[model samples]
Target: MYFTSALVSRSLIKNAGIIFSKQPVPKNLYATRLFGTSLQKQAEAFIPKQRIKSLLPTNNSFRQAVTRFCSKAAEPAKGQKAVGWWLVGCSGMVFVAVVLGGVTRLTESGLSMSHWKLLGEKPPTTKEDWIREFEYYKQFPEFKLKNAEMTLEEFKFIFWMEYGHRMWGRCIGAFYAIPAAYFWSRGYFNKSMKIKVGIFGTLIGLQGLMGWYMVKSGLEDRFQDPNDVPRVSQYRLAAHLSFALGLYILFLMSAFDHLMPTKQHAIEITQKALKLRKYAHISKGMIFLTAISGAFVAGLDAGLVYNSFPMFADRWIPSDLWAISPAIKNVTENPTTVQFNHRILGTSTLALISGMWMLSRKCKLPPRAHTAATAVVIMGWMQVVLGISTLLTYVPTHLAASHQSGSLILLSMAVWLTHELKYLKKLPK
Candidate 1:
């Protein structure tokens, strides 16, 4: 019985050890799993979705990565956006050139050259050449009629004035053109930007032609009135001034766009709120028209006619207001009428801008729009003061030029205000 019990215990111990002991894995089962896992991973990662690259036109996993439809506007390298600053320099040079042009006109120096020639081919370098140029001027109607008593030295002074004006203009063209081409080649502009700058450059060329065209009118005998002083046509002068102002606005807009591209997308007004924009546009139009009329005033030497403002020579409206025939002629050809119209236009511009500013307050405006509105009102008032001072000072060259520049500044403010309002989202009251 004891022997049988000991055998039973040994058998139980053997079974427990077999159950706990480790066994070797099958070679085929282990290899199958390792190979299958390796294959599965390769399939998951390398499967190209063979038709996807050409079919959907894009990878679904990266919808925002590549825009295939349209080009995105690019911002130039940070702190490397010197192109805008360069454009601003061009704008500033134009400002001085305009003022200098005004001085050239005010001094009666515009007719001195009598001919336009490049500095290289035929600029007068010697005293004898200058004397010969002056002698040539004596044959013109202006020298014969207006300055018959004028001497050669006096002619030289005026010649230098006009020559300086032309030289400055050439410099402006060089400054604006060369850099524009350089930036364009460097891929600084996208397709849309290329079109915009193209237009701007074309206008610059047009302005150059217009300058020559304006001089051409003075060089010819427009009307056979020997009694009339030889001056450029008021119409041509107005056209020139208007073109210059338009060019100025364009440059300023382009510079602003580059410098503050982020602000352009800041606001978008709904149709319901567009009236604020219209009023701003109207004010801008009025300011532009007033500037044009002032050009007529300068052309007719009308400022000299009515030396006193608020009243014209002891009369509210001068008796000679309709000095020219056909009544329509009175606007540009009539000195008295031109001055009267300038005054009216000036006052209307001031009133209209003030009204616009007040109306803007009635509506909720974005912060930028609000600031622009305030500037418009302030600039408008300052312009009025400048105009009155210019008139009261009898159109001194300094005062008149300031008034002209002030008009430009005021117009810019109006345009900017309009732009701000056009894109402006209305805030909640």
Candidate 2:
């Protein structure tokens, strides 16, 4: 009788289990019943259906639903803000570096170091050390051809200038790398941001190498003739400047992405906003091209060619604009042609930016974007004035450095405007 009773109880328990299993027990049924819905269902309501499907498990949906809530949410808001500020600081460092570079070039101090060191050199300290460094510089073509009469004290001045520039560049690397490693380890960057950070670090490294390569050009034996100025190659100079600009843009745009995320706009305003966006993009391209042309001008000392504005050598066009062989060479290799090209690019950039500003008046832009547009136009005018003033003053170190900085400032404004416009939602008209 006891055995039968035990068997009956076991059979009843097995049947109960079978019934419960066959009834399709919901995953997290306890929580679902308590909350009136599964967590996955709640997640589906807030998250995009397709994204949830992609991230959640087909077999065990509730197991990792919270884990895959939102990839963006992985980064804390505070961390993102900190990263944005960090990028802005990096951008400022690049700005200072560019200005210092311009000063180094203007002061004819770029080639004074004579040697390139990856980690950096120990700057001369003692009198004998200074003399030895000066002697080392004398061995280079720049000293042999141009600064032969430079005294030890004068040598110290130029050496310090180049040293400071190099040191600042090294600082930029440290500033970027340490923070990047921290942010990355702390999971501040999303996948896309990680790729951007990687690219930025790579560019910074290349920039350092390019700077050395440019200086090496001035120290080479290519300046065979006594009359040849011991200066870096125009091509190399332009490339170096372009690389810096590219790196600056990356830093700046990435900062904007973190600091100022896009906001959705109404469909009614889409058409006008789209049109303005196109103009802003074009204006940005023009600004970038103009700044690059200025690099060529600096590379060739083209600003010293014609110290007048709206005219080249007292004429609308210089007779020797195309003096270099193979007309294409004249564009970059010919000083006269380079200056003229820069003038045209600058004026056209100003005009294009002004036109875009006027167009902005017709369309309704986001407040920040409108501010950026205004800043671009104002900066455009200021840059043109600075360029003219620099040329008029025979490229005085102060004025010339400011002119170079102005180009970057103008570019920054254009970048800001374009970035703001890019993030705006565009709906079909």
Candidate 3:
């Protein structure tokens, strides 16, 4: 009976040991073991030394493992950063395009080409080629009526200006398309981003078409007066400018999304932030509207008439604002009305932005948001100054171009402010 009891006791002890050995150790315990703690020493008696050594990696190996894990985790963030910067570059190209377009218009170079090609034509390089281009220009109404005294050298200046603008636009397409395809193939963009990229591409194509359409309006023999200058349709000009602004906004906003994604903790927005957001939304809309109005101002060359600010022709409102028939026609068609309306809109936008900035100070905004708000106010005032200077100087090409660029800059700031204040979830009442 004593021998049988000894065999059963030994078997029970063996089974208990196997069960304890099969249990997994926590990572903290492994770390503790590595440090040679008392608890680890105590554990060594039960866990086989050979098994412990096999399970615990060397210090260098452990560090390498951790580094690999972290790098894997950061891969997505790195991809997003690349996409963000690419978008920033594209937006910059669009900015240059806008400035170049403004210069082309200011120089009266838009009508110099007189011919349109989708893929573009080779520029005149030789003297004979230059004459051929010049002869072609002479056939257009712009040359016959407006630039009849233009020399070949002068024609070259305008031709090169228009040519540069068109070529730059084509360059934008190539710059966007090649990078976009590579990124898309790399699976960097998700489904929604893919759709936005598609839309952006389509808009670029449409903008090119719209540009040609606007140019065509000028080429047609639709002058009502023999004294009328050959210029593109004001309506077409406004449309073209609007499309460019729209694309700029989209590109900039998308870039912000990639660069400044909202944190999960930012979902619970504060009441003051919510209120400020409303103000920001209004300011953004006003900025856009003011920009659109400036396009009309450019379209009508209205800045030339409004040389005086805070008053037009020494009066608060010009007398012939509604000189054109139907009154509504005067809003866009009449230079006096367009300039007056742009002045009102511009002043109102500035006032609205200034108020929003004041409110932002009390809102306890995020750091980035606070900075964006400050930028918006500063840019708002700067834009106003530029506009006034452009007018006071009688719309010199450089000043006028700067004024146009300033509008987009102001709008960009407004966009930045709004984006910083963007909320992922609904605001609590």
Give the Cα lDDT of each candidate.
0.73, 0.82, 0.82
Q: Could you tell me every candidate's TM-score relative to the true structure? A: 0.77, 0.82, 0.82
TM-score-better candidate, 1 vs 2 = 2
**Candidate 3 deviates by what RMSD?**
9.4
Cα lDDT of model 2 by residue, 117-197, tens digit = 899899877988988888888888888888888888888889899999999999999999999999999988888988999
The whole-model C-alpha lDDT of candidate 3 against the native structure comes to 0.82
Candidate 1 ranges beyond 4 A from true positions: 1-80, 118-122, 222-225, 262-273, 425-429
Instruction: Report the Cα RMSD per candidate.
Output: 17.1, 9.4, 9.4
Error of model 1, residue 232, in angstroms = 0.9
Give a tens-digit lDDT track for model 1, residues 55-152: 22233222222221111334344332576687668777777777788888888898887876543226688889978898888878788779989987
Q: Against the correct fold, how does model 1 do in TM-score?
A: 0.77
The Cα error of candidate 1 at residue 307, in Å, is: 2.0
Candidate 2, poorest ten consecutive residues by summed lDDT: 66-75
Deviation from native of the Cα of residue 25 in model 2, angstroms = 17
